[model samples]
Target chain A: MCTYRTTTLTVAGSGKGAEGWFPVTDASVYFDHPVHAPADHTLNVDLRNPSRGASARVAVELDPVSARALALAILDMLDSAPAGLVDAATPSGVPPAG
Target chain B: MTPGDLTAETVTITGHGGDAVEAYLAQPLAGPPAGGVVVIHHMPGYDAGTKEIVRKFAANGYPAIMPNLYFREAPGASPDDAAAVARAAGGVPDERLVGDVAGALGHLRALPGSNGKVATIGYCSGGRQSFLAACSLDLDAAVDCYGAFVLTAPPDEFPLQVGPLGHLVGDLSCPMLGLFGADDKYPGPEEVAEFEAALGRAGKDVEFHSYEGAGHAFFNTDRPSFRPEAANDGWERIWEFFGRHLSA
Candidate 1:
């Protein structure tokens, strides 16, 4: 089944694609049939820099369990980071830590 | 051009609004004038697997073509990249898909040795589009392989731009063959039954077969969903259906 459900967001980050590193401006997450993954359906994530062209993308297709684990790991890493360092990493235009 | 030899190449064809779109065309090197098939790629975009299906049609003596549905969104991009871009924007519009299929039909009819008979076969989302094209265009036959959102609407949570096409049954312009996996949740057995009933009510020439124990994408060789027994039988049914309707 081609689940037409997709969640998209604008992100400011760099991702390594086929041609090395590029700034990624957009990200789309969907649970659907994968392009290369062996599973019938997987959680697919495409981090892309549309301004740089379609090839400027880093993609991942993970099983649902693995994707959940990865998501939890990301949150854990962020939660465990030093508070000051996390605040310092915020975008420059944003207000500094109160 | 020896008999049984085939040639597959990339070509440009006019699509919706007369826009030039890239397409893959495959035809037997030498054969009698035969029916043409418009192979619609799945939602994954125009990749090697779909191209292989196009070639399979040619190998079976039918001239086939597949327009890159995402070419407008991401021209020159890799298949996966193009697919991602297209998916982000929203799936292809039904009107645009119809126009593209019309263009592909024209291209097929214009080919040398064409018998002027054409059919459509699509997988996944393309399956629904195949049914859509058959409803909107003049075709000899159409095959819908596990196309969802045809008999029933997607769940409210699904952010799909398209809706159920049950209303188009009366407009179907050709013989239709539907192959489905009984276990598929989208167009589950109940939905398939409703669709079949509607087709019958419309007095349409339709044939449907649901393979037990086979889920969606049973014919997709590259995916884990491939079910050889069902896929093989489905291919035979397709050939028979086409032969009955599209042969010169």
Candidate 2:
């Protein structure tokens, strides 16, 4: 069955796609039929930069367990970072204070 | 150009709103005038597997074409990329799908040596679209392979723009065939039954088969869901059904 449900978010990051590195502005995550995964369905994610064209995308298809683990690991790494260092990174469109 | 040989190529056709859409067309070089088929790719987008299906129809002596439903979203993009873009935007709109399929049917009919008969065959989401097209167009036959959301709506949380198509059964313009897996939860046995009953009540011609040991995507050779036994039999049924309705 094609799940047809997707979670999309605006993301700020750079991803290496077929054409090279591009600023990714969006992310779409879904669990449905995979394009190349061996499983019937996998947790699929696509980081994309629509302004750069559809080819400007980085995609990954992971098993449920792996996807959960990866999600937790990302949160853990973020939590472990120094608070000051995390705060120093400017958010999108904000100018750094001199 | 021989009876057993087929030619496959990419061509552009006007789709919804007269937009140029990319499509893959396959036809036997030499064969008696026969019916054509419009192959609808599953939600995974127009990848190699679906293209192979289009060629299969041609190899079996039916000229076939598959329009890239995502062409407008991502022209020249890889199949996976285009699929992602489309998915993020919510699945294709039903109105647009109808227009694109109408264009495809027109293209098939205009092909040289056309028998003036055409049918539609779709898998997964394509299956639902196949039924939708049949309700909206003049077709000889329509095949629905495990298509969901025909009798029941998607979960409320789902972002898909489509809805149950039961209301359109009365308008179906062609004979219909449905192939389903007994274990598929989306269109599980109950949903399939309801859809069949509705069609019957509408006084429409319909046939259905449910394979006990198979689930969704049994015909997809590249996935773990592929059930050779079921897929093989399904192919046989498709050939028989098409032969009955599509052939001159």
Candidate 3:
């Protein structure tokens, strides 16, 4: 089934895409059919730069268990970073003020 | 059918709002005037697999075309990326789908070898769109392969609330062929029955087949859910249906 549920957000970061690293301004996450994954449904994440066009994207499709595990791993790595660093509160999708 | 080779290529066609969307067209090289089919890609976007389906229709002697429904959202992007973008945008709207199919129908009718008969066939999300197009347009025939939410909406958590289209059954402009898997939970058996009932009550021309041991995406040869036996039978049914309605 094609579940149309999607969560979208703007993010300030760089992702290594097919052409090389590019600034990513948007991110979309959903749990639906995977194009290449054999699973019926998977948690899919698309980090994109709409300004650069749709091809400027990094995509990942993971089964539910693996997705959850990856989420925990990401949080753990961020938590272990120096305090005040890697904070979600920091403004994004823009260059920092000089 | 006249002796001819199959030709397939990418082209551009007007879609909803006169937008120039990329499309794929396939036809028999030297056949007499032939009927046409409009193939709608699944939610996975207009990928290579669906292109093969378009080519299949050509090889079987019917000219076919598939519109890149996500071209505006992700032009030149891979099918998967385009699908992700389209999904985030709340999927394809019903009005846009109708417009695209209408354009496709008109384009088909204008081809040099056209028979002036056109039909629509779709898979997954496209299945519902096919039914929608038939209800809203003047197509000759429609095939809905395991389309869901035509009579029932997905759970509220999914965010897509396009609503049921059963009320339009009475407005259907063409005969409909529905193929489903008894095991698919989306349309399942109950929804398919309801859809059939609505059409029946409307006295619409409808034919439905549910394979016992198959499930959704059974026609997708690359998927884990591909059911060869069911797919083979489904293809046979499709050919028979198209032949009866589309042969010039």
Candidate 4:
């Protein structure tokens, strides 16, 4: 079996994008723990597909698999959740972590 | 017809050495056979849970057979004593399992309601065995559920007694569909990848899926770890595969 190092990302920031979040390729990863995302923090970047160098902040809530994939892609970043985030965890489309 | 609509009979079939294997034969209550499906039980040996699985297939319009792999236990032993039954069966010597399953397939073909074509579906240990059946038995198709340790053994054990699937690589004569839980401990993503590569190397066709958030025994709804989403999706895939391969 291949060994995969587990990495955690703290939500730093939140936002909307021209297009909505694409679960398979978005920046967010999913986890079982809610601590993976903090609520009420607006994303400063785009949550949907970003033009090269463009950024947004959207809420990110990922299922366990999506979270893992996102975590693997961005190993050490944090994003803050937007206000009134009523879900168990944040959804992806949140802005990138600063 | 659904499982509730089947006319199932409980019967005992004698194995190579007077070893008796229990089985449930379910036929459609209203019509002719849609197809023949042989359901293999997981490592713990056949029990009420396995019987229920057979009924599920029967309800789908196929005549399903659930075989008791542990011949050591008398046919119809109390389902409560599963562990004892497995122990009595002496751990299913690897070499014998394939032949035994083939024997079961032969039995199914001869049944009155059955068509000559067959598909075998198995979980866990049965999953590994199902692969072997696909390789060795002249079946139309096979569905393997999270059967770990398939073709990933060390070089020294190149020929595993259980199925010897690795050795049977170039000789694989049938097509198979494999469903695995991405997070399963035994046959995790890495193992599935390697198995896929091996099949590719041997020039075999496979339809494989590794569902995220799903783990071992994902299809076993009665178990605590069952992943309903993955299981349902996998069942649809299996049904399509069987329909394509075993169709009249």
Query: Which is the better candidate, 2 or 3, if ranked by lDDT?
Result: 2
Which segments of candidate 3 are over 4 A away from where they belong? A80-82, A86-89, A93-98, B1-4, B154-161
Evaluate all candidate structures by whole-model CA lDDT and list the values in order: 0.91, 0.91, 0.88, 0.63
What TM-scores do the predictions have?
Answer: 0.95, 0.96, 0.93, 0.65
The digit string of per-residue lDDT tens for model 1 on B1-248 reads: 65557999999999999999999999988878999999999999999999999998998889999999999999999999999988888779899999999989999999996899999999999999999999999999999999998977665545555888988999999989999999998678998898999999999999999999899999999889999999999999998998888788
Let me know the TM-score candidate 3 reaches against the reference structure.
0.93
For candidate 4, give the DockQ: 0.01
Docking class of 2: medium
Q: Deviation in angstroms for B162 in model 4?
A: 4.3
lDDT string, candidate 3, B1-248, tens digits: 45547899998888889998899999988767888999999999999999999999988888999999998888888898788778767778889998988888888899998999999999999999999999999888999999998987765655456878978989999889999999998888999998998899999989999998898889999988899999999999999999888877
Task: Tell me the spans in candidate 2 whose CA falls farther than 4 Å from its real position.
Answer: A93-98, B1-3
Model 4, B1-248: lDDT tens digits are 44458778877765545456667787777666566888888754676677878887777777788777764443344442332333322346555666667666777788776768888988877888788777777888888888866765422222223333578767666788999989886687887888888888878888899999888777765655678999899989987898888777
Question: Which candidate number maximizes TM-score?
Answer: 2
TM-score: which is higher, 1 or 4? 1
Q: Estimate candidate 2's alpha-carbon lDDT, on a 0 to 1 scale.
A: 0.91
**Model 4 lDDT at residue B37:** 80
Docking class of 3: medium
Which candidate has the highest DockQ of all?
Answer: 2
Task: Give lDDT: candidate 3, residue B200.
Answer: 93
